[model samples]
Target: MTISNLQEVKSRITVFGQPMICRGCSHEVFIPYELYINVEKPGIGCLYAHDIAICQNCGEARHFSDPSDFDNEKGIFVWALRQYVC
Candidate 1:
């Protein structure tokens, strides 16, 4: 929201320079995974599901979760997703 550097303001998508509107409220939101990391709150750490991009207007969240986290090939988030889905 309060961006100081022009270079800092970038597209929200992972690849960068790709803008997309929030599905919930149709409000414009950037998916800049990098910017999100650099500008994160001190204790936020790495981004997660609950930490996905959120709409400023309606609080709709854009899920940027890692699919690997859901792979049975590994545990972690997948185990959590199964518990959540089942």
Candidate 2:
């Protein structure tokens, strides 16, 4: 499950939007949680890290690969959950 090339791993999963307002309570504050994917193959290895924003008022969560990606009118986050070996 080791990834040979870091670039080979790609994700196109948009979890949520920026300034993520809690759908439950319309809360603006959120708590961030770190996420990581670990790959272990015969001759390759890779580790990808991401973040998930959780609303403090409503406890809703959204996933994003990069924090900076959230700074936009429409936040589009991608995922790299798959591993590629070379």
Best by TM-score: 2
The top-ranked prediction according to lDDT is 2
lDDT of 1 by residue, 1-86 (tens): 11211122323433122344688777664432223443467776865323355555676766543222345565544321110000
The deviation in Å at residue 64 for candidate 1 is: 1.5
Give all TM-scores, in the order shown.
0.32, 0.41
Candidate 2 lDDT at 84 equals 23
Candidate 2, lDDT over the whole model? 0.45
| Each prediction's whole-model lDDT (CA) | 0.39, 0.45
Error of 2 at 12 (Å): 25
